[model samples]
Target: MSLSTTSLRSPRVVVIGAGVGGLAAAALLARQGLDVRVIERGQQPGGKLSQLAVGPSLLDAGPTVLTMRWVFDALFERLGQSLDEQLSLRPCAVLARHAWGPEERLDLLADLEASVTAMADFAGPAQGQRYLAFCERAKEIYDTLEQPFLRSQRPTPWSLAWRVGMSRLPQLARISPFRTLWQELGRYFPDPRLRQLFGRYATYCGSSPFDAPATLMLVAHVEREAVWQIEGGMHRLAQSLAALCQRQGVQISYGREAREILLRQGRVCGVALDQDAPLQADAVLFNGDVDALRQGLLGQPLRQAMGGRPLTSARRSLSAVTWHLQAEVGGFPLSHHNVFFSDPADEGYRREFADIAAGRLPAAPSVYVCAQDRTGDPMPRHSGQAERLMCLVNAPATADARPLTEEELLLCQAQMFARLTQAGLKISPSVHPLQRTSPQDFARRFPATGGALYGQASRGWRASFQRPASTTRVPGLYLAGGSVHPGPGLPMAALSGQLAAEQICAALRSTRRWQPVAMPGGMSMR
Candidate 1:
């Protein structure tokens, strides 16, 4: 059921930011026969889902993993497009490889039984059995929340509980919102190595395992479902989305920054772009961090629109320091996704988070290295050529206030490389260009965020409920991004955008000029 384009007055929607959230919203709204325009400050599409130039190769600068691909598939399908037709995707067999020392390494394969057998070989029969049990529990948690929480429009605790019903209260309790992720992992893995490995899931949401809720374990299940390697790069997904939006009649203006969301009579009326005339719209969808509104980065009106609330630094999520390079490497075999862990014997894992919590860089941080070239191709494909790699470590989100000094970053780099060397992987120095992005760099890239990558940290159980929903106090202004509900990551952000679009269409249904029709399964243009 799509809205009639022949209607006298079509709803005009302006989406600020060309991030996945903004792109997704623009695409959907345009498909519904509404006039949609997307404005991005950057020259290209993809906000965090971007690429960096490293010498002759382009390395993925942000997220490398692509999970929950159905989110995109369904989105494209609704837009009368096929994701497979638009982009090439290769399934990844090896989910990731984790290393603690030179010889001590574990690989989690895409196959569940294979991962279980590998765990058994690495830890023992008991550990293997525990891994199986953990998988079951993780699956249960994912299934339990998939409909009531993830797919729902920013459900509160009470609403979510009601959706779960009285009969499933036991299942709700099993989610273990009261306990931290670190504390919950103990029930599944006695070995500290396994605990550390599993606890790393918290970092997916830019959170510390010691503070994040046990519900984060569902991330393990999400990964187990599937991981795909996009041909070219993950940024290709952004390109495809942008292309689709244009085809759907969405006007996407690159290198255009939205300075303010204009309001008339306390309702969104237009958007004021940097150094340009304002764009009149019936509704506005903001795809950047909600904190930007609270902090008055966009405009003073946005602060008042947000009711003058401030997001504390303590609630901010983890930032990252990344080194993207195209380099020759040797020693330990590299997988597409790899993790070099800090020594657990010396409590380095706990200390890492504690140091970040105190706004200090960890002495020895756990590093994540993404071998972009190795994802879909055979090892022989890059026999002699340089591999594009992105090495990242979690850091404090205080770079906006106190940027990391060159001396401090140099020392941190040395320490990070030392950990890589200890894991038996070595990089050959070359004339190839390397891009080092500090938390301050991220802060500059995305305004109003002190380099907090995934919005506010998923610290307490209430944190999920605290994220602002699509509908805000402002009548015609909505929020959609990683900072909002359904949590962070590419798929989650896309869902947030879809939710905002739905809300916009539903609200506009009350107007006399346009009547957008929604079908049982989706929205359509009549």
Candidate 2:
């Protein structure tokens, strides 16, 4: 359900970060006539929606694929702008191209029938029918929770069961919360290869299929519903939203960090920024990881906002080692998205998870390559003489440790490229526009939290509610980002910001008239 927000009279809201959650909240609240100011420590608006440089070629460093387009469409629609009009997007015909080796390749296409045919050709008719059934169950999980859990402020299994009614409680069981995704996939896919392909969805949130909740299979249905490629790059999607925020009268300040969250009484008032005077406001929305709040990075007094539940390093999710490459390649027929699985004997998924559990990099990592320059056409595509590509190899959540040593980095890089070459994507080391990002690098990029990309992993059915809600123990404070409720992914983070804006609007509506809101200078958390 959408909030009926009326225009307000200059109530100030200071968003501490300019990431997707920050940008979305600011844009929507600005539309509600709130005086929104977005401050970022970086030069660009996007936090995780970052880009890498290879000579003149730039590749998207994070989130190469875009799915759940409706989330974005709704956000833009509320601002009186069409998402399609603001930016060009092409629907991907081939959702993903998967390969085990040179002779073993499968293309999951946009069309379900096409995919069924392809799967049948790859496996057999029985397997193809089972694939369709898998899609059905995946869709059921998404449809069951999309309303009560996904769109709500915060939800629990009890709340979800109540929403679904006692009669539909069996659907909850059907979601298989008790089983790991690997076990659940076995019921539908007897072939280990197919299981591996579908189970890879667990890593979408940086979790292992062997242990992640079976509910995560909903990801397959989510992506299969629709996928699009924004023009220019995924980073451009962030730029477009930032532009919309500016156009809607949001006061955006970059290169500024929030020194601390200001408080008046037990409630939030605004933020104190570095190198400038502290700006006061009615409330503050923290759009970074909740772990930052628990660590008292914002301020010790602000820890009260956490409502006593603190985040620990033990529950943090997975991290990665990514290579952004700009090069001219031959041989391998690259697609917009591709994956090269490691040896089957190693139980690639199990072995990799074990290595991460031990804080050691995987011996034979499953590599994901995104040829950013490649389009959906049958023939390969690129803008210039060379192409931009990126390969991501999963690694342990090691953002808190010392950056990998030279020897370790070399070994990881060697292991990654060797598998890539063996899987038919042969590229010379001389490839221009090459850069590598380690887990420690990610930690530095997004402070406090180790390089856990998806915040906390969705370990079980109960894991979803472990994240804090939009409204915290502190009356006027709010949480919005991947680290909070609704789980991780680009769309979920954007939705989180939207939910935060709605909550703030509701609270303000109860406290005052449409006149205005302000703060005092003498405010202190202590």
Candidate 3:
């Protein structure tokens, strides 16, 4: 798996971006006795694991749930540290709440049996049994992919098949990579509402269920595994990682942008900063969106590093419009995570994707609201007090080319709140301090992305395999982040960092040829 030639001196590695991926890579490299430095443009760490201000409250503006904790545990364990000692996390009793209308609601509990019972009551005994069977299928798919696909380096279809071995090809085929998630859901649930609810998992990767492969059902199994809530917002997890990096002798330079990646004789040698002199390094790991390099935002020399690949707008992932506010809630008791579905007349979530595909805001988009101040309790800890809430709706990743107008944005906002009211969740109009973020804002925050939350849209089965590997065409340069191999989500992003670190360490530790031992499906050396 190693690529670089052995060097006599200790290697100096510079990571661009203080995201979870970058921070994770830096920590592992530092632990390996390498001199590691992280460059971040923001005032603080945590790229998308970020927060927004509302008076004295800092609401989580990016990812709200934490899953696949084992990823962090392994990272800390490798660094000779403990993840539990670093951050406090409480497992959620109620996974999420879904509402189809004022009187129709369902809560998926952490307990499988309890969730089945609840589903039976919501739909019917037969549908409930179907749900139970669906859970089993999801688990089967997850079990099959966890070791061979997720934990390994970038793998093509041929490599994945070879790793699975000839005996298990049927199991791989059953994962249903050829069908769309939305279509597959119809087989298990005759109830349209149930189909809509489960199909929504595709959005986790910033994709539409109608287009994303059915293989995405693994997301359901991931949540079923467990969802933990950070004691302080999710941003605290980022800060904790940054703290760990510093303790490991990794220097973090905040407020300094990486203007360009320095290359010498067709290989990476260092990073050029916008505010300071270039940093000389034996290797460079980029944890930001890959599009930034392809678009020449990081200098023209590395623009063709991706082989002048064209990332068309049609291929971009979904973006969102969000509202962060502190408001008093009344009807429809809240859970840690809640989703309010659009009426069936709105075409059962299909129109939402179609509108976005046409570069138009959805007229009746479903809404996801995160009650930051609530646990499993029916009411907020401080009853009647203004609770921190973040409401979001799916939108097109067209801010850079087809930005929404002020009038269009207002209409979109109005429709979002209306959907909430229809579900019987009421927020006091006298709410103090509400902030809104559009796709345009996101595009500016993460350049050359067009505001895509996930690196690229998981449009088909091949899409997952299409993500770039940790190693780049330029030697000594690597990639990490949601956009790279393994896919998006807090844990997946961290795993991508681990993959990059493993490759860098292997490459630097020796010049002897080594077979990839991380997993059977791991990438072979070039």
Full-model lDDT for every candidate? 0.87, 0.82, 0.87
TM-score-sorted candidate list, best first: 1, 3, 2
TM-scores, each model vs. reference: 0.96, 0.94, 0.95
Candidate 3, residue 320: how far the Cα is off, in Å:
0.5
The backbone clash count of each candidate, in order, is 6, 1, 0
Writing each residue's lDDT as its tens digit, candidate 1 over 1-526 gives 1122234667788999999998998998888778999999999999999988877778788889789999999898888888999999988888888999988999888888888999999999889999999999999999889888988888888999999999998899899898999999999998889999999999999999999999999999999899888989999999999999999899999889888887776777888888778988888899999989998887887688679576677999999999988788998888898999999987778999999999988998999999888863223245756778899999999977788899989888998899999999999756876789999999999998999999989987898798889889988888898999887999999988888988888777765567664544465322
TM-score between candidate 1 and the true structure: 0.96
CA deviation > 4 Å runs, candidate 1: 1-7, 376-381, 517-521, 524-526
Better of 1 and 2 by TM-score: 1
| Candidate order, lDDT descending | 1, 3, 2
Q: Pairs clashing in candidate 2? A: 54-433
Which lDDT tens digits does candidate 3 get at residues 68-138?
A: 99988888776777888988988888889999888999998889998999989988888778988899999
Better-scoring candidate (TM-score), 1 or 3: 1
Which model scores highest in TM-score? 1
lDDT of 1: 0.87
